[model samples]
Target: MTINIIDHFNEYFEMVPAISDELKLEVYKLRYQVYCIENLFLNPGHYPDNLEVDDFDPQSVHYLIRHRKSGEYAATTRLILPGTDNPEKLFPLELYCEIDNSGVMQPINREHLGEVSRFCVSKEFKKRKNETHTLAAIGPDQQDYFTSDERRAFPLISLALIACVIKVSHENDIRYLYATMERSLLQFLSALGINFIKIGPQGDYHGPRWPTVIKITDLLDCVAEKKPNIWNFLTNEGSFGQTRPIEKPSKAVRSNSWVGT
Candidate 1:
């Protein structure tokens, strides 16, 4: 049976913006699970409240993917909007790695840049042997929480998260994106025709992560040309390519307290 991957994804999962405090909590809780408890990327004890949060959370937009049947959020990701008050504020990657000054990213407008970070999936959804507990090995699990088709659609979660990032960017009129990802994840994205240019040397933080950047238009172009199905799934079928422009926040809302997911 041919799987309509898009339908499979939509049937089982929904991607939503963390616009409210309740929704934001969902994002924080999931990050705590993946980054703190499960992976030990961050100290679990550091988050005494069981919610993983940091300085960047205050200036980021977040999204969570919920499993419709189980009502469990399976994955989460965030895009850190650039600082408006202080242009010199550093992105997580910039703080950890040396960005190349002489490159395609030099001319990009800072106001239009955002960083993609804090991507994670739940441990229960990781169901394959030797699968690195990442997107590469999402399959049916013994728990019966996911249907066979849902299991098959696991890899799409990563793509869907990227779609969310792109959606947030398009709505906000963002032009550039910075990210730090494992080389394996980068290669996987490449296989799906989502490409990024390395902007700095690989760093050891959270394992081997490469600092990379991409223009929003260039990313869209790559998807449109090399993976039309994915492009349609992201831009047309999902929440990313909505026609409504994101409303500009009022000055009061730009404060750190009002920002974050």
Candidate 2:
């Protein structure tokens, strides 16, 4: 029998909003494992409580993907909403990279913008052969915890995180998402029809990353057209429909040349 990717993924994993302090701690602890322990991307000594958090956490809404069978958090991501009182407050991308204000971003309303940040998959859930260096310690006894079909759907975790972002963005009336993404991640997302426009030169934050932006409407339309099943999964069977009318970026706005140091 052929497996429906959406059903297979839903069977083994669930997406949860980290609204309560307890659930939020789960998100933070998972981040600590990925960013501090596994990747060494952040200083473990700084987070004495063993929860990876920053000033942005207070302004962000977090989400987690949990392995239903294991009851363990598999991944976590956060959408940093625009400041309610101060809409002009710069996002992490604005502060760290030079955004080209003359083109596509010039007319954007900051109040309708949010940044996708702190996207990380837990080391325990990194099951792909190419991801061996992720350092997910699987015990001998737990080797068979995931069936072959379930393991095949593991890549859906990232898409589920994006779905979380979309869900929250819709609730908050956000129209554009800003992100500083690794090139590999950009390519992967592009291949899935979730394209982001590079708005700034590559920077060396968390290893080389490009400052990128995507309209929520455009993201949904592309996914819905190119991959209907994945779109159905992301939108929860059309429950999270587009909040705003589709608007295409003008041809006059062009991506900045990908300059790397």
What would the TM-scores of all predictions be?
0.85, 0.86
Off by over 4 Å in 1: 132-145, 237-261
lDDT string, candidate 1, 1-261, tens digits: 644556667777778789999999999999998888777888988999999999999889899888777889888899999887985688998898877744677698888999999877787677655444453233333344457777777888887788788878877778899888886678878876778888878887666788889887777777667876676566643335433222221222122111243
What local distance difference test score does each model get? 0.74, 0.76
Q: What's the count of clashing pairs in each model shown? A: 1, 0
Give lDDT: candidate 1, residue 90: 88
RMSD of 2: 9.7
> Each candidate: RMSD to true structure?
7.3, 9.7
Number of clashing pairs, model 1? 1
- Which structure among the candidates has the greatest TM-score? 2
- Per-residue CA lDDT of model 2 for 1-261, tens digit only, reads 644555567777878889889999998999888888888888999999999989899999999888878889898899999998999999999999877744989878999999999888876676554563332222122234368767666778888888888888888999999998886678778887999999988987665788999998889889877877677666655655643332222211111100010
